[model samples]
Target: MIGTSISRWSMTYFAMALAWLLAALVMMVAGIGYPAADLATPNTLVLVHVVCIGWLSLAMCGALFQFVPVLVAKPLFSEKWELPALALLSAGLVLLLAGFLSLGGRLPPALWLLPLGAVMLVGGFGLVVVDLGLTAWLRPAGPARFVLVGLASLCATAAFGAVFAFALAGCAGSAGEVILAEGIPLHAVAGLGGWLTLTAMGVSYRLLAMFMLSPDVDDQQSRWTLAAGAFAVAVTVAGGALAVGFASGLNVVLSISAILGLASAVLYGRDISGMFRLRKRRHLELNMRMATLSFASLAGTGLLGIALVSIDAFTEQIGAFAFLAIFGWLSGLVLAKLYKIVAFLTWLETYGPVMGRAPTPRVQDLVAEGRATKWFVIYYAAVWIGTVTLLIAEPNTFRIAAVAMIVGVVGIAREIVRIRRLADVAGPQRLPIGTVMPHLLYANP
Candidate 1:
């Protein structure tokens, strides 16, 4: 399904990614030879929103629009929502980013738009959540439940983000302080660890099987892995909150929950790797390649946490930890998948009707992979370099890394636009077989 609505999702994700990249570029130029701030600057904060909500969230939404229908054997509840959602999301992101940049400077009143836009953006997510949730419940099987859990995590993420948004607006009081101290961190944990990561796992389960040409892995092991993973996220997140609020035996509770979380990770790793080992296809596709890297990053982050904790280095290098989890692992997977997805979508809309009977186009025909490979390489390289640079507190290095990311962003945007044009063509090639098709359409085909 990652590759199903390839064009629509591609256009969405790339547009967002490009926005994020531009934001990053702005910060890079503005902060040149300046000290890297403690937390992300207003500029960087805006970029963060653009990346997480604008880029990633939109990508997921577009994919679900196409994926859910196939899973349930029904079209979307409303195609009309698509264009509106896209426009609202894009505009909201712009306003939100503008607000953050303004807040960075003199904390202007215009920053109000940030929250206003955020509300609209969240509304967009809410629409998707309600629609997807209803559909998920209707079928109530396959990967939909995992999708539901992921959606639940996303809701939690948005609520927590709203708290941060309020904080940005200077509206936070004692309640806001409490959330930042306790609720905010927990929100991030649930958002990234629970929402994004869980969704990735759930999607990977179905997608890995499809790309590998294997039978559906709807078995006890698969069920347990997913269930245990979700349970671990709930318990750990709740326990962390209780520990923070009550201020009693917090360390012990957290430690125990950490172990459970680790165990769940181990189980999921085993299951996903087993899928790869038992793969029916001899070679991996681009999506699987990126997905494998994601799993590896996920496991590696867990191991790194263990190391940091063992050596009492956790407090000192916490920023590095966040960087690896979010940028290194999660961003890597997203970028990789985006490459394949855009091309896949382009093929579908432009070419799917002609797939079965004729000498149909292979998925690879949509993009010249050689041209795209450098960006992927550079992006990941920047992630690792940036991680080390952040570790050592070097501004110049950080700027260079940021620049590299921007370059990668431009590359991605170019591909996305290319795909969109291909998808927009309506012609005989797009028409179904055995029809007295319009002659005008045949020329393009």
Candidate 2:
């Protein structure tokens, strides 16, 4: 059964990650971090790390533990390491945040925690990467290839982040300055574009087709999209490294990378459109409907990146672009997918075993869709409004929008918790023969 294949500790990690996300949003809304602060300030840095490392990375790792087996048709290499990895990552993130907070003062003890935290975080991620890599390698598939590459990118991103930690702690020499100057942008690109976005693309390629009852997308267009995206990320990383090691011709290389990235983004958009057109499900679920916004935001972010580079306005536009890419695209997609995934996983855990023995509610029956839909709508709307206000340099409007987004997030979180406790509401209901499950209603398209 699917439940047997699922990892035991994944939900624990997911719950913690969601809490971190909500906390970060609350901090932003209260003017204690992010939108109210300059991009280079410690408060902004703290917010970025919390969202990227504490929230997104943790969530994605938990998902990988649960879904990689489904994608590659094999079990995970080691579920035993999940708890240790979680402990290390959680402790490391706390230390890292503390280090950033104490940067304003000459606290050597706090500064020392930066590298220590880096080690723990990298070690935690390393263990998962090895486990997942081995599992993917056992039965290589198209989607597995993307996931492997993404894991490599995650390692590279973490390595660069470690260097940045030491540099920020005043431990790196002149070389550190060069890395600080050139590597920061590269770090963001690799983490957001290469690791997170690429991984999401690969996972979506499989999940979307399955959930929508669409045919497998093993076409030439899909291969081209993957190839183009890989090339774009490689060139961007190489160019950034070269700029840091040898301070010459930064503009030319960055421009080329930007153009290639734009091309990759176009190909990805086309691929997604093709998937939707081929889908057999006439009425899309709320999660799929919300996912469209994320796809659009990704395309918009790419176009904005290209424009910013072309006009030599990278410095001025980086903050807004980062916001759109992180909050508007990545976080938005995660929330949308979680709307379905949480209920699906909860069903597998609570009801999968008793399916034939007794009557059980369908996965969709666990969700309160009428109540949850408005939360997603409000969240995405607030995100767009906040992004626009930030771009226009209006702090007050952005804070107001952030508050609305926080409320939306809290609402969705509440719904997810309710879904987990479904037995309290519906108890058990019997269904007659030939009854179809809501999630699999379009299974035979």
Clashes of each: 2, 0
For model 2, residues 286-378, the per-residue Cα lDDT tens digits are: 889889999988878877777777888767867788888888889988888877887787677656656787777777787878888999889
Alpha-carbon local distance difference test for all models: 0.65, 0.80
Worst lDDT run of 10 residues, candidate 1, spans 435-444
Q: Residues 344-402, candidate 1, lDDT per residue (tens digit)?
A: 65555555555566554456655556676777667667767776787687878877887
lDDT of 1: 0.65
Off by over 4 Å in 2: 1-4, 106-109, 306-312, 423-427, 430-445
Q: Which stretches of candidate 1 lie over 4 Å from their true place?
A: 1-10, 25-35, 40-44, 167-173, 240-260, 356-358, 416-445
- Global CA lDDT of candidate 2, please? 0.80
